[model samples]
Target: MPSPRPSLTLTLLQARETAMRFFRPQLNLHDLTEQQWRVIRILRQQGELENHQLARLACILKPSMSGVLARLQRDGLVGRRRMLEDQRRVLVSLTEQGEQCFASMSLEMEKNYQRIQQQMGEEKLATLLELLRELRGVKP
Candidate 1:
């Protein structure tokens, strides 16, 4: 028989859902969907990226990225430009409006993170992050 509370996938999903509960309201306040916010946040941090690179880093499917990007572009939150040296290579970046939105959201997100850290204790939170990175195969 399967042991209760022993499924890795289920535990991960539960953790994600719990965190999203806190973040969803913030996303709604910004009038942004999760995927849109993910795109904006990554663009804000990385400056410029190819659509595929952005999609991969944001954990968004490549097919879905085009639509997300289109909406963000229509909303004036993202810009797409072809490379001068390689015209076929399209690069994407956040616009000034996007930057402003990101800055505002970042403040609230950081506050939420601090709350979680306080609840869990800073050391435990750090250790959890370390273990998660290990599970994700990210180099320390």
Candidate 2:
């Protein structure tokens, strides 16, 4: 007889779903989708970036990033400028408005993260992080 699958997969799935549920409400309050927030967060982390670099760092496809960039530009949250030396390269950065939004969302994100850490406890969270890195074929 075939052996039953391990329960770890289910546990991981449940953890992901629960975390998303917890974050979704906070994101909604910021009037941002998860993808939009991700782009903003990436820009904050990397400072200014070229369009292609932003797409890669955000882990989003070029086409999707085009739309995200458009929306952010329309909302006055981000600004784009052509590189002085390389006119073909379009650089993207968060505007003051975008920075403010990110700051607000960052606080909420931190709170959510702290809650999760508290709930999972430090040791379990550390173990989970190590396991995830290993699963991703990354050196932990």
TM-score of 2: 0.84
Best by TM-score: 1
Residue lDDT tens for model 1, 1-140: 96687888899999999878878989999899999999998998888999989999999999999999999999999999999999998999999999988988898999889888888999999999999988999555
Model 2: lDDT of residue 84 = 100
What does the lDDT come to for candidate 2? 0.90
Error of 1 at 34 (Å): 1.2
lDDT of 2 by residue, 5-90 (tens): 88977988898899888689988887888778888999999899999999987878999999999999999989999999999999
What overall lDDT goes with each candidate model?
0.92, 0.90
TM-score of each: 0.92, 0.84
Ten contiguous residues with the weakest lDDT in model 1:
131-140
